[model samples]
Target: MNYFGIIRPAMVTCLMLMLYLAIVVVSLITGPSGLDPQLLSGFSLSPVTGDSEMANVIVTWLLLPRTLMALLCGAALGAAGVLIQGATRNPFASPATLGVNAGAMLAIVLGSVFLPQFTGQFPVVVAFSGAILTTILVFRLAQAISDSPVNLVLIGMAMTLSLGALSAGMLMFYENRLDGLYTWGAGNLSQFDYQPIQRSWPIIGMLTALALLFARRLDMIELGTEQAESLGVNVRRTVGLSLLIAVLLSSTVVSQVGMISFVGLIAPHIARGLGCRKVWLRLLVSTAVGALLLLVADVAARLIPLLISDSHYSFPAGVMTTVVGAPFMLFLLTQRKRVSALATTPGETGIQALFHLSPVTFLSALAFVFLLIFGFSLFGNLDLQWINLRWPRVLSAAFAGAALGVSGLVLQTLTRNPLSSPDVSGLTTTGVLFVVLGLVLFPGLGSLEMTLLSIMGSGFALLLLLGLSRLTGFNPLLFALAGLCLSAMAATLISMVLVLGSNQSSEVLVWLSGSTYAVTSERFYLLFISVLAVLPLLFAMWRRLDILQLGEYLPSLLGVRIQATVAILLVMVALLSAVSVAAVGGISFIGLMAPHICRVTGLSSHRHLIPATAMMGSILLVGSDWLSRTVIAPFEIPSGLLVSGAGGIYFILLLLSGKYIQRR
Candidate 1:
């Protein structure tokens, strides 16, 4: 049949196959140093010497296997994406989005760290188990709430963050044991031989075939559950089987390549856009598209070094895919038809009755803060030398945390989204990215300069997000998705910098994970002044913020200049987040957690909630700082990492409780 009366399906298929073959040939001929002339000579197993032998070895052992592995893994991920998206009836669904890849990677990291021998023995089993279990958990939790596609993705995102935090923490603490694993974790496809391909292809092939067999059922189910049931399809059974196949396929790929993202997500969309309507046809096209996409990405990864004249530095193909895919996701969000279809129900006004903060509760919070400060100050040694070194660190964490908390509250109020925060909104990542870029481009920048760069980056990111989100009238889900895309792109760029063998990789990693170790007196003072500067403005806007929470219409009716107020508040958030990130790296979730915690305590008035949130944030981070310093003693963990772990768990629980309350 002709597609759109412009192209034939068979012709499209043939074109895709031909393109794939051409790219495969290109991949084989290419290397870090470019094309090899000797590769034109016929293959020889003879004991040839010099260029021919070197070329033969590189082609046969390294380039060929890596290329083939990329094709196989890409095909597997593509098929898996189609399966999950079909089963969930969610266009945004993919193995990465559903937490399968993160789960698998986390499990493998845990096994390798805690049970090295066992992990070394049966790595595949461990990966598969993690992927399946996490998928089940995400699905169950999402099901518990509602079957809204948006909710499923949100829950999956939370799980992915939680799992990722655990994986990062383990790798950081056990860096000695997991050396070079970070490169692999970032998704490496380099191969020394064919063993990985030899072992994994069969499983990948079998899983893809099984997924295809369910294509008809998936198509029926897409007609709606009742319609599918009437058509004699066992909807639940089909979904379960499809998900299982998807997890297995994805985990198999992860076990070999370690978290290649967005292949599954990008491939199916490309196939469908090419007018592949039938489920089976779409699956076939998607698999081919996925393989081709990954092969091209690998080629780009190899060629990047040549482009930059930096032959010594190269990064993972996964980074290349992410850099490409993130923008594509934003493009998808901009499509009016897709945005309308994914439109979410308005968020409920949770816990209407606000209780007064009792004196005991206020005093208890104060006591906790003082105790944490004191403990953090005197935990190791009480000498003057120790105090001189330690006080800066403690105050830095406190001030930075308070800034983040207040920033988060402002963001939530302005966006009218409870989940809104600097980190979640991509402001933190953008700020961190700019600071890292500044450090790379112009090393030895002072604290003030770095903070300026950070604010500039964050403000730019906010403007970009707001511009794109305007197309959808600032719908909360779409806004969040846009921020997510921005964050992913920023993060991928940072990873590219890290993988380029930067001299500051070690320090950057530590700081990126939210270490307070390097915070000096000067840096602490800079953060203190920035936070203090923003407070008076925040206090003046408290009434305006409260009016905003009642929605934009009411605020405008009340004679509040809504646009000016929101613009100013957003600027404050960017400044606050920027300074905090400059001081302590990307300490996340404090902004998210602190605001929610304050709201839960019955403080709805911005007058009361603002300081409460700031206090809560300070206590949380100071306590995290104390634990980070004390837990491993001489070996300090990044306080940001610990907070992220706790925050991820808290975020998930918060989602569940909110859903339950809404149901009630």
Candidate 2:
């Protein structure tokens, strides 16, 4: 009767274990065939031969491995989250946020495409190698910029986007050979045998053990580096080793289960909330929590069809995790007391002073555009028929890119954050999500219908982002973080829709990847009209943007209506982004890159910046479209993927340059 205080931790652990066991049972019995009473009786280690043989086989070979894999992967990811957060002294750190998962995914895709023999035999090794390399790259870049948590996460996100785009490009190129990988890429837990589970569990266990061994050191390190070093803990060594173990654990799971988002992130918080204070206890609780979360998600993934009679597709467990986990991430952001904000006048004076306006630069940009146009027009042959086919795509790319450029410029000025862009701010992805949903619901949605859906989605996303970030006064880094969460959710929803709409999946995938393959004169005209319609409104706001750049307080003092101006600018951005995305799918980075390119060229005036950015964006996308068509010839890469890959690299470089680093 007096055991409550004496065995609280044990009691909690036991309760969680019981819950996990119940869920495991549910997972076993719930699936397409529904609950089988025979499974309960016939479930045995050894093969059963009788009326219950089928149940025994299903339980033994199918359900057991899948259920066990989910448990093990969740435990590993949860432990990895604890290790990473402990090492970084930042609660936001996780494998998915730190580029580890993306790197592992890219490695697997590369191995599958280039070295199938080796990759097939040693997928874990490939994933680990990729994870380690990307982790190193992210850490190095983040350290070089600043030691802020926001910087680390932003740099990690940059690398993740770049790696993800590269992986997508490869997947698109080799879709025929890697047909089944699309589902696996979304994080599947289906298993026919125990081989993968057997291979993964031992490695996960060993790495997790190593992580637990560092518990005391991590606890000390969390006290602060100076104190930890004074206490005889090699702070650097502990952090590095902890991160290494985290990567190993995460990569091990990814190698088996593909990319499961947010388990690592969600579990540690749950453990802490459950009153696990000490590092060791927290790690253990986090392990349990992660397992429970993943198991529950997997069970939900399995039970959806049973619960919904018309549902035919079983969504990947990863999508379910994101559906649940993204909100958690946003909640964490809202709880933060302070987030690093970008400097009000980001490179306004310094950039302008360092690089004055040069006609040569402008002329060079123009020449490049003309050159790309020439190449596009005459790349394959000098035939008029080829010219007629290529012109619409080239023009569509130019108009869409211009719209994105102006949109990005407006957003950057509005938020006073150099990193603000339609794609990064969730506008493009949300727009694409709605467009895809429309396609799924209506199947043959016309241009006007798609554009309307895109506009509605983008507007909703903008409002949601603005509302969520308002809690922190719209701090730039937190705003970006919030947008990233929205983007992830939209992407997961898009994936689910694509999975469910199998008939339109391929076509939608191509469009979602930002293809210009289907561009025609009609589509080109729609893009042109949309871009032209928005340009005048944007130009009229240039003066407001310039004044707003001086900072919100100054702008208000100067009689500028900050809220009204921002509201107007955001509506314009949403419109531009919606139209562009409708025309070219969810192309990323043009909005981010074009305006930055303009700033780098010493054009600080909004008047000049807006036009120059539009032109630069047009040049960039037109050039990308040309490369997409010519690089692999008959098989084209998606222009959006190309821009994303290039833009990701640029973003990392921008961080490395320390241009965006604002010292608190």
Worst 10 residues of 1 by lDDT: 655-664
Clashes of 1: 0
Q: How do the residues 502-586 of candidate 1 rate in per-residue lDDT, one tens digit apiece?
A: 8766667889888788998889999999899897789888998888888658888999998888788888988899999889998
Give the worst 10-residue stretch by lDDT in candidate 2. Answer: 343-352
Q: What stretches of model 2 exceed 4 Å from their correct place?
A: 1-4, 7-11, 44-51, 305-312, 338-354, 359-382, 658-664
User: TM-score, each model?
Assistant: 0.95, 0.94
lDDT score, residue 535, model 1?
A: 76
**All candidates: CA RMSD (Å):** 2.4, 2.8
The TM-score, computed over Cα atoms with residue i paired to residue i, of candidate 1 is: 0.95
Residue 32 lDDT in candidate 1: 54
lDDT of 2 at 313: 70
- Candidate 1: global Cα-lDDT? 0.82
Error of 2 at 383 (Å): 3.6
